[model samples]
Target: MTPIEILNKIVQAESNAREIYSEAESLREGFDNYVNKEIEEIRKQYYERADKMIAEAKERETARAEAAIQELDKKLEAELDAAKKHFEREKDAVVLKIFKLAVDADA
Candidate 1:
């Protein structure tokens, strides 16, 4: 081939290579976009799961705390009842002793 003809062929080959490279780049960009969208969806799902788990855990903790408070209230009520009974007994004993002393002095 003539030198000019060979140069023309080289230019044509280079142009075809550029077109192929551009098409490949476009396909790669599209795939990357698809992958990013899928990743975002997965991340959103993970967050939703985490939120649900956290809410369940909070409910469990609240139930446990309520049970503990109820138990403590029952114990406190029992202790108060015992204290009241003891105080009444002591008051009656002291009153009887004072009455006896007053009557014996009069005698």
Candidate 2:
């Protein structure tokens, strides 16, 4: 072959190699972008799930607190009723005893 033809063939081969390298670089960039997007989506989903769990936990705690308050109120009301009954049973006896004491003192 002629020197010019050989040199032209070499130049063509180098050009093809450069094109292939460029295409490979572009494909790698695209793949990297795809992976980054998937990672971001996964992170977003995880945060959303965590937030929902926290809200549910808060609701459960609030319900427990309300129930405890109601039970305590019931106990307080029962004690008050018992005190009223005791007072009613004792009030007449206490008044009669005082009256007897007054009469004895006067005599």
Candidate 3:
């Protein structure tokens, strides 16, 4: 071949290589974009599940706290009722003691 023909062939080969490289780069970019989108979707699903779990846990904790409060209230009410009955039983004795004290002071 002549000098010009050899140089032309070399230029054409380089041009084909550049085109192939560009096409490969574009395909890689598209694949990366698709993978990124899939990752984002998976992350979003995970966050939603986590949020639901957290809310359920909070509800359970609140129910337990309310039960504890109710139990404590029942205990306090029982204590108060017992005190009232005891006071009632002592009322007459307390009044008699006061009466004796007043009579002795007068004497």
**Model 2 agreement with the true structure over 5-105: per-residue lDDT tens digits:** 99999999999999999999999999999999999999999999999999999999999999999999999999999999998999899899999999999
- lDDT per model vs. reference: 0.98, 0.97, 0.99
Q: Give candidates' CA RMSD values in order.
A: 4.8, 4.6, 2.7
The global Cα lDDT (0 to 1) of model 2 is 0.97
Residue 64 in model 3: lDDT: 100
- Candidate 2 residue runs with Cα over 4 Å from true position: 87-107
Compose the digit string of candidate 3's lDDT tens values, residues 79-100: 9999999989998998999999
Each model's TM-score, in the order given? 0.75, 0.70, 0.80
Error of 3 at 68 (Å): 0.8
Please identify which of the two predictions, 2 or 3, would achieve the higher TM-score against the true structure.
Answer: 3
lDDT of 1 by residue, 18-100 (tens): 99999999999999999999999999999999999999999999999999999999999999999999879798888899999
How far is 81's C-alpha from truth in model 2 (Å)?
2.9
